[model samples]
Target: MAKTACDHDVLIVGAGISGIGMAAHLEMMCPGRDYAILEARENLGGTWDLFRYPGIRSDSDMHTLGFVFEPWRHEKSIADGPSILEYLNRIVDERGIRQKISLGTKVVSANWHSDRACWELVVDKGGSRQTITANWLYLGTGYYDYDDPYDAGFDFSAFQGQVVHPQFWPDDLDYTGKNVVVVGSGATAVTLVPSMADKAASVTMLQRTPTWMFSRPAKDALANFLRRILPEETAYKITRWKNVFMQDKSFKTARNKPEKVKQFLHKKIQKALGDHYDPASFTPPYDPWDQRLCLVPDNDLFEAMKRGKAQVVTAHIDSFDATGVKLKDGRHLPADIIVTATGLRLAVAGKITVSQDGTPVDFAQRFYYKGCMFSNLPNLAVVFGYLNASWTLRADINSEYVCKVLNHMDAVGANVAMPYLADDHGLEEEDLFDFSSGYIQRGKHLMPKSATTLPWRLNQDYRVDKKALAEAPIDDGIMRFDHVDQRTQQQLEAAE
Candidate 1:
């Protein structure tokens, strides 16, 4: 049986970056209104808390990832997981948000109560159930959960060596003097394999396909130094804007022209590893960011390989035995530790079981309003970041807009709002993303569409978000709200 324990003004579903940002904004904007964040995990920092693999760091710089209110004091733009987690914890503590956080409470479902115009949420924790009735619900559950990595038909238990999935890396597992095979070619694999190779006798990154490796400065020293002399805000704005532009331009080049991307990526790879690294394995067949692009930490992964600490083997793995992995190409790499850095299942709403009054909407059936909100759901705002920059950059804008929405709703005495799309084109689930990953390709029919490039296509341009959220009128015609007429109000008051 469902249990009713508490009620609040707003019930936030995740305690991650977006969830924290929402709590901070709500408390800052509406001072005393009751609100609470329900976290499924026992800790905070959703993605950072989950992935413990070495070289696990932010792909985007800190300047953009950081909240506008809090200036990241560190000189390093690309921060490690621990540092990022510390910053988030500090934000929560400084804001006195710990009380607002409800740990070990997992929200199973949020059912809308039309009569009360609020949500009756069922939460499970410590083998008991509690129901929270909230006027508003904010979702911060990330796109992926490392705790339960969905099986892609690859049997992992049969592997003989110490199997360490990045989702849950055991600290006690010793890889020293052991042959380790790291599966997958994404950033996690790139980051962990090189670092693991330092201790492991030999490291191999197994891949079913090719990947694009782009060189990046180890740390932006100049960007750091500028923060000291220049105003903190100025330095942040400069670095943030500059990085966004550079990243966009680089991505655009790959999309608009294949030849240029090929030449530049190949040239850099060749220069970094000299003649030892094979160009074939390094060369990506698809365009950059087609699947997820690999970011190199000052070309360290290749350097480790050239130095004979690591190697990249491109092949499909058939199965795993107690001793090692058997490749489809009739090769066996005996390993003591196997790290499956395989990709994750792409989910938009963090598996919260989204529905409306016991009527569940098929994810494939609904059309996207803004990459940020689902059409036809009033007062329900979704958080989805740009595919280009860090997830937080776009999320920051989304949080700000949500605040605007909240304030507007209070002023108008309207508790419901949903951003509706004018033209669905009958195809939101078309093959929008050109990636070939199992998650992307399989879920394409269910994901949002992007027919035109920027602005309308769920693009990740930060400037575009600034214009849309900050500059545009909050009560734009795209979203509708209901207000009682003065005659109806007077009649109700007289009757009362």
Candidate 2:
């Protein structure tokens, strides 16, 4: 026997940045459409609250990362974790979004009933289980797994003073005056190295290969200037466009002129580190933006390296020793603590098992529709941000697009909207995410494929997606709309 909870027009999974933004959009646009947010954690703030590692901050500027409706009034564009969390919480409280949130409720699976034109979700709250139904399901659960970090299968029991992954940093463990060897050269390691440097006796970033890193000011001068002269919303819009255009241009330049971009990056790094910079230690084998660029605000990492508090070592780890990690080159780096900032273990749709009409829905076999929803998946939208730009930029567009979709369905007296790839659509399957990052590569098989053309491909460009998803025709022939009769709804429930 199962208990039934009240149904909602929309059910948002995850109360992170994306979920919060989605709720606000629904409240303002969808008026009477009732919705609820289900967060697995006890509290909200999602990633910002979950990641409590030292020196955690946004890689992108807050101008573009902040919600379009809410301007980030902070001095620092690349904000720290606590400030970001505060911003998220403030939005929830000010908008009364907490009333719609069901905390500590983990949705296990979502099964769609075609006849009923609704979804049946099995959720676990505390020790009891209940069934929740919704007309639309929005997934804001981020791509990575919160519990597990990709450790590269290293055995740490032999010689570990304290092994930690930034994803699951111990609350009480202290690294003061400790000799720490931070593994990997990604954003996390770079952030951890500089942050731990002030306290640690020495911090060494050990990487199999070097990554491209460049510096910018911790504060946004243009955003500040605009705020002082213009109205709050006006300044925010201007700053947001300024950053978005710059980021898109930079990414295009890197893609088109890889050699020039590489040289420019190398020169920038050389200037930052002065004569002490080693080409081999700081230079990446791939071109700029081959993987997402690591951000070093105010040249903090370079300054730390120049100050002799931290260093970068490019070497492959052979194995773990009783005292430290042994390099394949026969060099040993001694450490009192090891932080594996290797990568993340990716999970799709929060690892939920999806079944359509009693058959399992393999996301790998499906194509992404507008990078938000999947083909054949009705009334479902998964929020995945842009790879080349700020995450929220794309998320903002997605929320608005979903609102348009919901409104269109309601206006037509349609109960559901299903996307399908037609045989004549003329689309070649490509990986949804084009990034060469380790986490993406590891989880590529689990993700949905995309077409080569519009409406089917995941347009990572915010401008393109905004026009296609938000402004394009809602009845684009790809999404089929239909109404379910009372008898059909009854039969669908009986089949369950």
Candidate 3:
């Protein structure tokens, strides 16, 4: 298990924010490590490149969403898709990470050889199968299934109108001057309704249940003021911390004082919608932050409703007629186009088949270790973002933590590092994600198990994780590190 036996020191899947961020961290932390990024799509930006639906923008502020290494100079903190893509592109180009990216290369399966202490990846490139080996496998592939979104089981067979899913939005589809009906009440639906309202003859957001919505200006005034007064990186750091603090406080308040938070949110929405605000359509069955709240920048959605361009209907779908949707309440809504803003289908490890030796690894059975690695898994890390805050917040910490682990292995002259758990560890299993969102609930079985204790659970709190992941000692009692020669000698002795 020599280092020369592997093609590269690291193989990063998906050339999106997470992959690019990991590469940047490696360049800064582990200078000489050889790494390659494999992206299935031809483009580099993962989510930004995949989604082309109109009015697509970041629900979170850019200061927190953008990488800590890079400063977001854009005027709008809540930027659109193209702007975000530009920011990512700048990062890769400036960091010299662009050259290491392999476009149109898909990693189909990864098998870890314990004896060799490396990962053998079978990939599909240009419809041809090829094998690549690496010492470490870092999956930056997002949680959602790229090939398919969550199916709401809508029957549109008899509908003559065009139906489209936001995941695979057609570039040529036009809904101008046509009645459009968007299904679901999550972020996607909330974003689509007002975006389509400008040109559509009528835009209706059809939801089975309402989602909590909050409105704010897209541009951050304080951030802009600070940027003018201070250096770019300095301002970015300050703004980043400020937003992070506010986000944590808001989330905690929502959890601790749901009723008070709900009233505050209701008041905000009422101010925006005014005469158009209806409790039935605006109020969700759950409390704030129970599911991620929908962000409406500058009250755009409410403005559209006030202008009579967009409307919200709280009802269940009965079926689809030739012209439109029929409500379960015996009401018919006419539409020429139906956009299924339905949620995403969650997938673990980018749907890649992961195995140890020749046996497949079921993530659901393994305990999550430090929100990055899994128990009993060696030299592998996956980035899953925070549910309550900006995704990059988690990605940044995870990338830095993985770099620390790699450096620790080098310092100790260990070829393999794994979090080892005994068969009867007596750890109680808890839900990995605490969200009641449909996507989380539906995909719980595919996710790794979480324990009640630290280092064994996938923590959602950024403040807690930042301190633990950054400053914690690498050689904890649970993590086993072994040199190749030592491992071989142990194997020989065991065989004897």
- Taking the tens digit of each residue's C-alpha lDDT, what string does model 1 give over 1-496? 0111227767888888888888888767767768899998899988888878877888777877877667777867778899899999999999989888999999877776544556778889987998788766778887765456745567867876677778888868788899999888887888888888888899999988778888787678767888879998888777777877887787777788978888888889899989776877987677776765678868889899899999999988999998899999899988888888877766756767767877875556555555566666655656666666778876777777777777787777776666666664454343455566666665566565553532235655676767766777878886776532434444766799
Instruction: Please give each candidate's TM-score.
Output: 0.90, 0.96, 0.97
Descending-lDDT candidate ranking: 3, 2, 1
lDDT of each: 0.75, 0.88, 0.92
Question: Which whole-number lDDT from 0 to 100 does residue 116 have in model 3?
Answer: 76
Model 3 residue 483 lDDT?
65
Per model, how many backbone clashes are there? 4, 1, 0
lDDT of 2 by residue, 1-496 (tens): 0111228888999999899999999988888788999999999988998998999999999999899999999999999999999999899999889999999999999998876767889999997899999888999998888777786888887885888889889999788999999999999998999999999999999999899988899999989998999998999999999999999999999999998988888888999999779999878888888899999999999999999999999999998877898999999999999998999999888888888877889998788888788887888999878889998987898898889888888788787788877656667876678788999989998988888887888887787777676567989877898876646557776899
Q: Which ten residues in a row have the lowest lDDT in candidate 2?
A: 1-10
Ranking by TM-score: 3, 2, 1
Per-candidate Cα RMSD to the true structure, in Å, reads: 4.3, 2.8, 2.5
Off by over 4 Å in 3: 1-4, 485-496
| Poorest stretch of ten by lDDT in candidate 1 | 1-10
